[model samples]
Target chain A: MALQAGKGLLLKADPIAAAFREEVKLGLSKTSRRPRLVGILATSSAPSKFYAEFTRKQCEDLGVEFILKKTGAADTGDLGEGEGVEEAIIEANEDANIDGIMVYYPIFGVQQDHYLQQVVSPYKDVEGLHFKFHYNLYHNIRFIEPQSLLTSTVPSAASAGVVESEEPPPGTVKSIIPCTPLAIVKCLEHVGVYNKILPYGDRAYGRTITVINRSEVVGRPLAALLANDGARVFSVDIDSIQEYTKRPQGGADTSQRRYHPRHVVHPSNASLQECLAISDVVVSAVPTASYKVKTAWLKDGCVCVNVAADKNFESDVRDKASMYIPAVGKVTILMLLRNLLRLQQYKAVN
Target chain B: MALQAGKGLLLKADPIAAAFREEVKLGLSKTSRRPRLVGILATSSAPSKFYAEFTRKQCEDLGVEFILKKTGAADTGDLGEGEGVEEAIIEANEDANIDGIMVYYPIFGVQQDHYLQQVVSPYKDVEGLHFKFHYNLYHNIRFIEPQSLLTSTVPSAASAGVVESEEPPPGTVKSIIPCTPLAIVKCLEHVGVYNKILPYGDRAYGRTITVINRSEVVGRPLAALLANDGARVFSVDIDSIQEYTKRPQGGADTSQRRYHPRHVVHPSNASLQECLAISDVVVSAVPTASYKVKTAWLKDGCVCVNVAADKNFESDVRDKASMYIPAVGKVTILMLLRNLLRLQQYKAVN
Candidate 1:
């Protein structure tokens, strides 16, 4: 089991999970109708099945109904061949009973994302990957202060009557923050990592979090989320990990730098010695392949989130840190269910 | 002058600007109707006028007509008080000759983003912040390869009929990357920094670029852009600069740490002694107030982008680095024109 490696510090999320369930139950009762979620799985791939099944369990346990819409047809979203998926999306979009719609990502062997986004209405886009939803996320127009970017200091941007507005600082846009990252953050908070990091005893403020992968599903979104939440994110990937170590090159010119002399990345052997040395948290998404990392490199009791297929950390590394395994994956599902239920209630009232 | 700092290194955007004009000219000639752009200056703010005029000059220089629509309305998008703006958008959308529509951002003293997004047609959205353009950027669906995120792990994500597809790696989803960051990148590349850092002399593949502010407009977007382009981004603001300076805490635990133990920020005097010590590029967005940064902290020739209003660097600091000033901010205007022209051609062809 993924949790087996975390001798005792793995942070059994039972209490947080229970509280989320209670909140979802309360929200479900407040809704006008039963909050239903339709998860469309267009592939029977093992990973897809595993994730789909996990979602089903999380939803069922939270009193939300989950319907698995499976398709054997090899309809790719790229070739515009997702007729079945599109029809299903249209049906769900119009379904009054359905509060949210989540299409399992990476419809394996095919690409139907375009069709899915087109068919699924923004109102039901719980995944928030649709461009319509991104509008709210980007929030195009932001109020500039009297002293922000372009101001009255220069002869350039100081003439047409610009003034300051009372709008408070827009810290970060949360609409673009995806679920998996949110889940990891929630788990970290639940485990008291924020208490250690932030003065307010909440929010991941001023902490150094390292995202060891750059994938669309997890690393990319997580990095964005952490950076917005007032934490500095150091993102290192397989193609670019070697460049991140911040080697101590004292007054050294480019030609005389201490590292990467030949510019070749030794993937499995590349040492993130400096990165781990400073990181308060390490979220590793590199899967299966054993990476040469030592627990001593990280600060004591550092939070580790391993979102890989076979777990990104070795047993020795996992045992020393607090870890969230995406394969175990209960916390993120719980989080999504809680959000969906709350969104349903909001929809019902307004 | 901002260009004075980089006597030998200040990259002139003349060639890039000329190429962009040629592209726009070609696009305009290919279309049945002449390509025109509407510039909506809903405020008389000096900063807004300055930006609007700069854009007008660029457009006129490129043989494109620019019309400035001035309004001093205190309308809120959420309140639906932007009727005049909506009408103008409707007119622009219907006008086939108007190939692009540019709305000067932050109509000072009004909250009208929702109104603009709902009214402006996506085809005319030259800013690419519109949800329609973002769809191509977010690209809702992705194909799961047998490799990539995880591989060959049983009982993981392996059941729901998943299979591999032959799609090449998505080069980069660029619509979300705003113009300022792109301009900063172009400036850096033009200054020969990529050649200094990246292998094969192309792009910010593996360089450490520090963004000094966390605003929604510049710093946030720049960090995301740099990270996506494979650079190590260390973000710092006045409030958070102290936490970033890694002072080599050797099991210092909590008390013996070098800084942030008291959780108080020395805003005016806090030196980023450690951050600049390692950064290859420092994008400073803090305005008016000069930071207490020292020349000795940085290695020779660290690129600095002083986006601050009155300049954040001193003569001593500026003397050692290549800098870009918003006063001679032709790169961003050039980038936007390039995007608009390409978008125009794509719309015309499609």
Candidate 2:
């Protein structure tokens, strides 16, 4: 195996995504009103805090105003800090200059993320994590209300919550897809896989992708995102990997339909090895500290991404693959910031 | 292959779903306040009208109030009938007596459905298509707020849109899954698969299912639902099914985690036949009218549910399968009505 120590295999959103950001920023710079963003963290989780700080710095670099709302135990109170968090979110929602609002995951050291998310006006929900962003996803990005320069993915402002509004034809909305999923897409584009073979940049057209872990925030959404691109996605559990691999040679197969590619393999080494032997791409959402990635069965050309902070793959696992993205977290921040920039510019254009 | 006639194959709701619905209905009947549901259709499509009428009849049978607001050409007048449709939905949402609100597809014709969906308050969104329903899917059905007996998947109401609500522990919330997907799950359960093997009552654990469409409404959501149940799902397209089956089979395999199990097959009739030979379930969300299902390669005992209205499978094809669901539409309406009953009862309990 040609194990080049960090040459070209580690994927990053470079020329393509960065170029897009520059273009969006240029348009935004010409606008009189600068964009401002808010970051709300309700937890003491190191990862959440780290991400919030990362976002703050990114905002500064982009010349966007960043607001930080941190809620702790006493502040949240015994009844739960959800109320206090709600008040802060509502305040930001009412802020005129606020162009985007994002909550670090596990809001308030708990999974209250969605509760606080709905409070932020969809107009500023550049992350597209809000429910309105999802509702609007049914419509093409063009129909998004309070329209600015829509990203063609996130339903723009004007279309937000306008239920009675006319909808574009089906198969048009690109899904104001969540940030992390979009980041993966951007990475695929960075690798020249998107706009080449597949649409979501997973380079997954006619390809098979295996996603480890079934997370609402990452694993499932990532699988859904890839499945949208006509690729076959396999889902498994972290604790039960070996068992899934040995169970059977064949698992479930969907009708090339978008929602049909999640599978919990019969955790058997044979099944695991079987999946590895036939995979085109693999995503490790949960850190596999115990699993020996180097000995894992996988195609030599398989592309991989590790989204978790803890490194799952062994040192040589990266050696066997064609490419790997060690920077999914950073890419997520960059992509989110870029989306915000594009959205702000879209608002200006409107 | 031995094919059973109309005797044992067509899959429909089993005793479980019916039993659940009956229990829900019993609760609703006991409640002093009758559950009132409203159906709004903005098109003349025979299908839409038929569905509305079917819903109305079902409501009558269940002892619930059903209201039909049909907005056609004259009422929706040009500009895509978006404006007029919005007003009607808003009115319905504001109605205190309306327990649930549903909109037949093609609100102003040509899939302009979302336009009419957003105006219905989340509280009345019985269809479970709303983003609020989706975001709130994280909460247990019991905790659904505003004291409405929320459907299990949609999360109850009092905490509806409350941004600062307390967060439930992760992975505890049972998804208030969409109606159509639930219908398929029920069919699986009816066929003795769900609880027999899978917890979703679909016997999906370790099973492989091939979904045949890329529908946002049916295919993707169905895949997600099955993924939640730990089933191995393969997604594919109607046109390129053969080609996909022929693609090189080394897909990207994930770590022994969950949610990554989509595979592109080698596509030999041998391979397609192999998948069908091994599959436990198959669902065709869209009508594969052009595709011949008679000569289609499949196993004998594979249970199938065709969600599309068009008869994709030839008459003879049904003769070979262990079970098939010919009544997806009927089942969908039944499940939705049942959900309304459940929600009303849940509301009463609150």
Candidate 3:
């Protein structure tokens, strides 16, 4: 068990801990003179508990103060049957002591409709779901958010426009690419992966990337990012991929496989074989009760990432995976801390 | 031949042209009384030719003007002798007619030593390579280098300090995350690829990610971005990997392969077997003269991206890959254009 735990730590815990420490130190150093207050507004016991412990450890190490205000879960039946959580959130917005606040709530529930636009002080709205925060992000305004992914997308999209054209915007805030996808790119960097045969520092250009999903939150932003980074991206909506693949093949054959301009498939109509057959990397964002992808469906030596939570896949298949990132696992916590620190820094400087 | 040409266009030309037009229109509409003037400063004719035709088509469509000024290839003797291209760039910098300037030179050959800081006007430095531009990026003061891998690491580091400690410097600007990696996260967002499935307007929260890299330019910034998005992240570096392998034993289970974490190899000593055996997604940045990965080395259904620009690998392993992103392809130009537009927008607002 100790060995397994050690292995787990090696595989998971240590990196997160190290990142947390590094971020905390940096966060604290940036605000060396001011007493910074971080407020976490959470309704669920789980997230609040995690934040309390994690923040406590981080604060203790960095000599920073962290406050957690538990507002209880979103009240599902307050305003017009299911608007209680929004009201509670609005109340929290008025709190004077909070510097940054994140209201933790499930992605779906009875309260989603009413709670989507709940008011929170922009400065205090650390989670970045507020209209003001999104507006700032979409418009590339300098502001604070709990996570970089939310705020970064606007900049990332804007920058995508730049790399694709000769004339980029002047004084435009460079796009802030999404964090999760950025993490994957970071993984490649850490591993020293570069364009084949290029010397160090040589830019990687002209790469072709096929994205399986097209969500505004993830797929669209990622496409913009890849496009910006000089990679040719083919974005296939999970719902409309077949239309792409039905087209005739085109382009030079750089690899073993011929270039298929339209290789995407719609999951609703796609056969498992077609969905998993041709991809070099398969990133699945679908939320399914069980594994939507199987080992048999995968190609050899392919890279796969299931960004969904829940132990939805088969363990045998997972064991054969090249890499696996579990939802809310140890690694995820460290990433969150690092982002939080960066957000604080942005708020301080801007 | 026409079919091949069409395929080539599908593979490269069309997307780039499309991206160029979209970016120019989007970038110009956001700013400038007249059509924005984009100046191309190049030593080589490659980018000049591409941009001339690409931007011209877009300009004609939008009634914008695209300018090309060539310095000719810098004297190899001067470049080899360590004289920088600063002098040549100064001409473009001082050009009154130039609204935005992109200095395209080989990464090698020319001495960059402070040349990035010396020649290009910050306003005209649409590529965002200047120190001031980088500083602005770190502080979130300006968004210029949209697709460069360095964007995410710098800003995230600063923001982390602010978010965790709530005491960022009064006027410090946060770092910007890298563009390409962040794109993946954005892609996921567009597809609603989350465990909790938050509504479109609801605050996005309680998510976590694991980053697998540590490159200063790519990994560090990306981690920071994830944290900013309110997702917990676990970051793993190459130094920490341990390698082990398992084989069938005792014939008890023919179908099951033996597993061992003990055989995990450090990233430095990574063999093809060790690296691909355990990873879920492989974002290869290894600069190689040939394809470093083989079908046999990869696990079934691995997602692999060859970010290297070298045409080093064999073209027969498509069956093993789920997706592949080539290096230095058409997408980069799009990203550059988008970044320029974003920068312009930022300037307009601020």
Docking class of 1: incorrect
Give the per-residue lDDT of model 2 (tens digit) for B171-271. 32322456887777767656665655332222355666776664545665566556445465665554333212111233645444333222212222334
Q: What's the TM for chain B in candidate 1?
A: 0.66
Q: Which candidate tops TM-score?
A: 2
DockQ of each: 0.01, 0.02, 0.01
Q: Which stretches of candidate 2 lie over 4 Å from their true place?
A: A1-62, A65-350, B1-8, B11-21, B74-83, B108-112, B135-175, B197-203, B238-274, B291-295, B345-350
Model 1 CA lDDT for position B34: 52
Best candidate (score: lDDT): 2
The segments of candidate 3 whose C-alpha lies over 4 angstroms from its true place after superposition are A1-20, A33-64, A72-97, A107-160, A163-181, A191-227, A230-238, A242-249, A252-272, A318-320, A327-335, B1-350
lDDT of 1 by residue, A251-284 (tens): 5564543332111111123357677777778888
**lDDT tens digits by residue: candidate 2, A1-350:** 23466533655545445765576568568767777788877655677777787888767877777888775532344323232455456667666678887876664321235445554555566776654454343221324334422221222234432222235334332235567877876676567555463332223556666777765456655665564444556666643332111111344453443331222122234355676777777777674556544425768878877777776666666656788776576667766766676566545545
Rank candidates by lDDT, best first: 2, 1, 3
Ranking by DockQ: 2, 1, 3
| TM-score of each predicted structure versus truth | 0.45, 0.47, 0.37
Weakest ten-residue segment in model 3 chain B by summed lDDT: B258-267
Lowest summed lDDT across 10 adjacent residues in model 2 chain A is found at A240-249
